[model samples]
Target: MKLSVIGSGYVGLVAGTCFAEAGNHVICMDVDEKKIADLKNGIIPIYEPGLEAMLKRNVDHGKLTFTTDMKHTVHNSDIIFIAVGTPPDEDGSADLTYVLAVAKAIGQYMTHPKIVIDKSTVPVGTAALVKAEIQTQTDIDVHVVSNPEFLKEGAAIDDFMYPDRVVIGTDSDEVGETMRQLYAPFVRTGNPIIVMDIVSAELTKYAANSMLATKISFMNEMANLCHRVGADIENVRRGIASDRRIGKAFIFAGVGYGGSCFPKDVKALIHTSSKYDYNMRILTAVEDVNQDQKTILIPRILEHFGGSVKGKTIALWGLSFKPKTDDMREAPARVLIKTLHELGATLKAHDPVALEEARRLGLDKMVTLCEDNYEAIRNSDALILVTEWLEYREPDFEYMKKNMNSFAIFDGRNIYNPEKVRSKGFTYYGIGRQ
Candidate 1:
């Protein structure tokens, strides 16, 4: 298959690269000439693990390419993927300007019948909207398929290489079979290729994200309650996770969930329901819980400092939303840094890969960006483990004890053992652990 993935963003780049790796000729197209140039020059914009190397290999092999010429790319490909960003609007609905723009451009320039896939996470009925938009521009029959991506940021390569299931949304069996053939290489282990209605496939992406976000909020609420009742959330999490039904995944009592997908998708789902004269009450509370959960450690920090953070220097061990990627969209560390800065507390933060993104987000001025985890702790009053990166799991406690102005460790991800930290003669504050 010859495929052209529009947008050249995270999803587009990854999907295009992976498809090319699977023997398809792929051209990743973007309107930004600079970005296209940078990609062709092997300068990846995002810091996803294993992406740059794979992209370079595919491009070197003549399997993958990058382009800014939309008409040339669209007319040359049999399958065009609308993989643009669907950012959230002010009213919380998904902003579809980019997706619709790509759709219009594809329709205008397409000379033959093509299979168009909605690889971006858009709201339900977007495929219908895309079909209608394309039909207005061209009389050619275009098959619009709703095939949402299920790739995780840090582990996108593995996820794309071995997908658990492939969902293809198309009314026609021919379109479904064509999508299945494209995805056949990834699901060699007999994982299902679920074929569903277009609307159902679009809703699946939102429903999946919302359910995961619900679990995260529920666990955070449980952790908060555990703190009040003098119980350990780790033990509670273990107890519940042992059950066959409640198998552990996102049950870790973290600060909160944040990324490009969950925050935007949850709000968009709520907004979509409102348009249909319905209220997603559970998801509304989920959003509220997550918003509060991001700054849950602020009060604890104040209590530790005797009700003030003025003149205090706090160290943050992680800045990204999670490990192995440099994405800072709606990251919990931003909430902590903003709140602590407002209270006159100076911050030194470190992440293995997110410093560049933090700098891009103007967090460098708000906090001291350090070179390493230990450097971040130098002369700090308290150390907070924000992202739970693997390197922060086991550290030289003596070095940490020697460099800090105060002996306090706030384990945001509960990756520390309370007894061991207390034995080191340092104050340890873990989420819902006594």
Candidate 2:
């Protein structure tokens, strides 16, 4: 299949590369000439585990290519995927400007019948909007299908190569079969290719992400309650997670959920509900809980430091929202950094891959980026574990005790054992840990 993905961003890059690896000729198109040039030279913009290797291999094999030519993209491909970003508007609704713009361009440039897939996460009924926009450009026959991506940032390559299920939204049986054939290589393990209405398919992506965000918020709420009741959230998590119905995935108590998907999708879903004159009460609470959860450790840190963090030097072990990816969108560490800086706390932070990104985001102004994790803790009053990077799980407590101005560990992810840290002759504070 000759496929063209419009928008060489995270989803487009991964989807195009994976499709090329699966024996399809893929052309990843972006309006940015510099980004297209970078891709042609084997320069990847985002960091996903195993993506660089796969993309390079596909490019070497002549299965994949990058281009900035929109006319060539529309004319040369049988399937055109609109994988652009739908960033949230001020009102929390997904702004469909990019997706609609791509649709309009495809309509103007397309020479023949084309299957346009909505690969970006857009609001419900967006497929209809995309179809209408394309129709207004020309009289050419076009099949607009909704095929939202379910790829995680760190594990996108694996998720694309082996999806749990593929959802295709279209009214025509032929369009559904065509999509199924394209995704057949991935769902060979008997995972279903669910074909449904366009609106349902569009809503599926938001629903899935919102549910996961709800789980995270619920666990964070539980963790806060445990802290007040003098109970350990870890034990409570273990107790509940043992039940088959309450399986563990996003149930671990963390600072909060953040990324490109969860926070945006949750808010978009709530906004969509309001548009229908309905209020999503539970989802609204989920959003509120997550917002507050980001700053849950501020009070504890202030109280521990004699009600003031001014002039205190704090060490942050991680800067990214989570491990194995450099994405810091809505990261809880940002909240901590901002609040602590306002309190006049000097900050030193380190992440294996996110230092440059932090610097790019101007976080270097607020927090000092260290190349080494130990270097971050040196001479700091307290160490806070923000993101649960693999390296931060176990540390040389002896070195921390000797190098720090004072010995205190704030475990935000609860990755450290309270008894173990306290045993090292240092004060330890863990979220919901007794």
Candidate 3:
């Protein structure tokens, strides 16, 4: 099948590349001429693992191409996927300006019937809006299918190549079958291909993200309670995670959840529910808890310094939201850095891959970005583990003790053993570890 994926951002790039890898002729279209030119020269914008190699292979094989021409995209493709971003509005609802604009362009350039899939995460009833927008431009028959992506940032290639389930939203059985055939290679292991109405399909993406966000908030809440009660969150996590019903996935206590998805999706769901005159009270709490949880370590750090981080030199072990991705949207480290900087703390930070992104976001003005992890801890008063990167899991404590102006370790992700750090002649503070 010939396919064109509009908006060659994260989702569009991965989806288009994966489709091409699966033996489909794919053209990834973007309005940015520079980006399309970069893709043509084998330059990928995002830093997703395993993506560059796969995209390059498909391009080398002539299975994939990049273009800035929308008319060519609409005319040559049997299936066109709208993978544009739906960033949150000031009121927290998803802004569909990009998605609707793509739909209008597709309608205007259509020469015949085509299948348009809503691959971007949009609000419920967005498929209807897309369909109506397209109808206004042409009388040619068009089938709009809601096929929301479930790809994770760091592991997007694997997730696309082997999805647990494929959800296709359409009223037509023919469209459903067509989508199933397109996704059939990925789900050969008998994972479900769920076909449902457009409304349910749109809601599924929000519901799935909100539930994961809820789990993260709930665990963070529990970790805070454990800290007050002189209990260990790790032990509590182990105790509860043993139960098969509440199996462990997103239950680990951390600073908070952040990315392109959770923060906006939770707010969007709450906003969407309110529009229907129904309040999502639980989701509202989930959003509230997550916001506060981002700064969960501030009080501990302040108290450690007798209510002042003023003139203290603190080292941060990680800068990204999580490991293996350079995305810093709503990263907890940003809040920590901002607060610490305001309190006159000199900051030194390092991440395996996010140093350039941090510099691009102007974080270098507030904190010194270091290339090596050990270089970040040099002469620092305390070391704080922020993102839980694998390299920070085990460290040379002897060197840390000798090089630091002070000896204190604040384990935000609870990846350290408090007893071992204390034994190394350094003070150790861990979340919910007592």
Candidate 4:
């Protein structure tokens, strides 16, 4: 199969590379000539574990290719995937300019019948919109399918190669069959290939992400209540997570959830609901909870420092949203950094991979970026574990104690045992652990 994935962003790059690895000839097309040139030269922009090696191997084997020529890519491929970014608009709806632009280009260049898959997370009915836009350009037969991606950033390759289920949305039986054939290699483990209406398929992506975000918000709220009641949220989380119906997934009490997906999808879903004059009350509260949860620890830190963080040097470990990825979009660490800076507190921050991103975001001027975790803690008043990266799980606590002017641990992810840290003659604060 010859497949062309438009927009060499995160989704497009991963999907194109994985499809090529599965024996399909893939051409990843982007309008950015510089990005295409970088890909051709084996320069990957993002850091996903195992992606660089796999992509390099596929490119070397001639299974995968990159191009800036949209006409060439569209005319040569049987399947076209619109995996472009649908960034949120000011009103919170997904900005469909990129997706629609790709669709129009496909219509203009396509010479034969093609299956166009909307792999980007778009609002419901976007498939219909894409189909309508394409039909205006050419009379060629085109089947627009709503095939949303469910790839996790850190584990995208594994998720693509071994999806729990594949959802294909198309009214035509021929289109569904074609999509199933393309995804057959991935679902060989007897996982379902769910075929549904295009609208349902588009909504599925938003619903899935919102539900996960709901879980994170609910746990964060529970953690807050636990703090007030003098109870441990971890104990409560463990108690409830044991239920068969609610088997644990995103129940950890963290600062909040942030990434390209959850924050955008939740806003988009709420915006979509509003278009129909319907209010998604639960999701609205979920969003509110999350916004506040991102900086929930600020007050605690302030109170601990006698109501002023002025002239204090705080050590922050982990700048990315979560472990194993360098993505810092809407990261809780950003909230911490901003608030601490406003309070006139100095910061020494360290992450395994996000230092370059921090520099790109101009965070270097606001905080001291350290190459190592220990270096970040040197001469700092307190250590705050923000992202819970595996490297920060266990460290030389004695050495950390000696380096810091004041020994205090604010465990945002609850990765450390409060008792163990306190045993080292240091003050310890974990989310909702009394």
Candidate 5:
């Protein structure tokens, strides 16, 4: 199959590369000439664990290609995937300008019938909107399918190659069959391929991400309550997770949920509900809880230092939204960095992959981005655990005690045993442990 993917962003790049790896000829089209040129020179912009290697292999094998020529890509491919970014608008609804633009371009340039798949995460009725946009350009037969991706940033390749289930949304069975064929190789392990109406599929993506965000916010709230009640949220989470009905995943209590998906999706869902004059009460609270949760450690730090973090050198352990990916989009660490900086304190941060992104986000000028964990903690007043990277799980307590002016640690992710750290002659603070 010849597939053309519009947008070489995170989702588009991964999807196009994986599709090409699965024996399909894939042409990824993007408007950014510089980005296409970089890809042509085999430069991968983002850091996913195994993506660079796989993309390079596919590109070398001639199965995957990148170009800025939209007309040629649309004219050559049988399946056109609209995987452009739907960034949030002012009202919190997904901005559909890029998706709709691709639709119009495809309509103007397409010479044959094509299956236009929405590989990007968009709001409900977006497929219909894309369909309408393309129809307004030309009356050519086009089947717009909603195919939302559920790949996590760190484990995108595995998720794409071995999805738990594949959801294909289209009004016509003929379109569904074609999608099924495209995904048949991936679902060879007998995982189900769900086919449904296009609108439902679009809503499914938002609903899935929002529900996961709800879980994270709920857990963070419980963790905060645990701090007041002199209980450990970890134990409580363990007790509840044993229940068969409430299987454990995304239940870890932490600062909050942050990324490209959860924060935006939750807001978009709430906005959509408001459009119908319906209030999403639970999700509204979830959003509120998350917004506060991101800065949950600020008050603790202030109280510990007697209402002033002025002249404090805080060592930050992580800069990414979460571990194993360099993405810092909506990262809680950013919120903490800005708040701490406003308090007249200094920040020295370390992450396995996000140092460059921190520089790009201009956080490097505001704080010191270190290459190693020990370097981040050296000479700092306290150690602040943000992302809970696995390397920070165990550390040389002696080095921390000797190098720091104060033996204090504020754990936003609750990554340590409070008693154990206290036993090391240090005062340890966590989200919900007493």
Candidate 6:
């Protein structure tokens, strides 16, 4: 199949590259001329693991190409995937302007019938809106299939290559058959290719994200209660996870979940429910819990410093939202830095991957970028473990003890054994652990 992914962002780039790797000729189109030029010059704009190598290989093989010309992209492809960003609006609803713009552009320039797939996570009924927009511009028939991506940013390549199941929504069997054919290669291990109504498919994306967000907040709330009751949430998590029904995945208590998907998708669902005068009470509380959870370490830091961070030099380990990627959108570390900075504390931070991204976001000025983990502890008043990177799990406590001004450790991820860390002559604080 000849495919055109109408965006050069994360989803589009990955999808176009992967599709081209699967023997499809792919043209990636975007309005940004500079970005198109960069892609043509073998420059990948994002930092995703294994993406650059795959993209370079596909480009070298003449299977994948990038362009700023929409007309050429529309006419040359049989299937056009609308993989643009659906950024959240001020009211929290997904802004569909980019998706609709691409649909109209495809309709205007398309000289033949094409299969249009909604690859971005948009609100329910967006496919209908897109179909209407496209039909208004052209008399030719277009099958607008709702096929939301289930890829995580850090592990997107693996997710695309081996999806657990592919949910393709279309009323027409013809469209469903076409989608199954496109995705069959990925699901050769007998993973399901479920075809359903367009509305159900749209809601599935929101429901999936909302459920995960709910679990994170629920665990955070549990962790908070555990702290008050002098219980360890980790033990509780283990106890509950053993139950066959509950199974552990997103049940871990941390500073809170922050990524491109959960925060925006949860808010969008809440906003969508509000439009119908329906209140998503559980989701509302979930959002509330997360907002407070992001700064859960602040009070602990204040307590350690006797209610004042003034003139305190704190060393912070990890700055990314999570680990394995440099994407810091809505990262909890930013919230911590902002809150701590307001209290007049000098922060020394270190991350294996997010240092450059942190600089790009202008967060470097707010905190000192440390060269290494032990160096981050150099003459610092206290240590805060924000992101749970693998390297920070077990460290040279002697080096930590030697370099730090104080032996107080505030672990946001509950990573360390409290007794062991305290044995190293340091005060250790972790979420829901005593």
Question: Candidate 3 on 1-434: residue-level lDDT in tens?
Answer: 99999999989999999999889999999999999999999888888999999999999999999999999999899999999999999999999999999999999999999999999999999999999999999999999999999999889999999998889999999999999999998998999999999999999999999999999899989999999999999999999998999998888898888888999999999999999999999999999988998888889889999999998999999888989899998899999999899989999999999999899899999999999999999999999999998899889999998899999999989898888999998888887778
TM-score of 2: 0.99
lDDT of model 3, residue 200: 96
Clashing pairs for predicted structure model 1, backbone only: none
Residue by residue across 252-295, what tens digits does model 1's lDDT show?
98899999999999999999999999999999999999999999
User: Residue 103 in model 6: shift from native, Å?
Assistant: 1.5
lDDT of 4 by residue, 1-434 (tens): 99999999878999999999899999999999999999999999888988999999999999999999999999889999999999999999999999999989888987889999999999988999998899999999999999999999888889999998888889999889989999999999899999999999999999999999999999999999999999999999999999989888889998999889999999999999999899999899999999998888898899889999998999999999988889999899999999999899999999999999999999998999999999999999999999989889988999998889998889999999888999987898888888
Clashes of each: 0, 0, 0, 0, 0, 0
What lDDT is obtained when candidate 2 is compared to the true structure?
Answer: 0.93
Clashes of 1: 0
Point out the worst 10-residue segment of candidate 3 by lDDT: 425-434
- Candidate lDDT values, in order: 0.93, 0.93, 0.93, 0.93, 0.92, 0.92
Instruction: Please provide TM-scores, in order, for all candidate models, with all chains considered together.
Output: 0.99, 0.99, 0.98, 0.99, 0.99, 0.97
How high is the lDDT of residue 93 in model 3?
A: 99
TM-score, candidate number 1: 0.99
Q: List the residue pairs that clash in candidate 3.
A: none
lDDT over C-alpha atoms for residue 72 of model 2: 91
How much is 347 displaced in model 6, in angstroms? Answer: 1.2
Question: Which tens-of-lDDT digit does each residue in 148-203 have in candidate 6?
Answer: 99988888899998998899999899989989999988999999999999999999
lDDT of 5 by residue, 54-100 (tens): 99999999999999999899888999999898888998889999999
Q: In candidate 1, how many Å is residue 79 off?
A: 0.2
Clashing pairs in 5: none
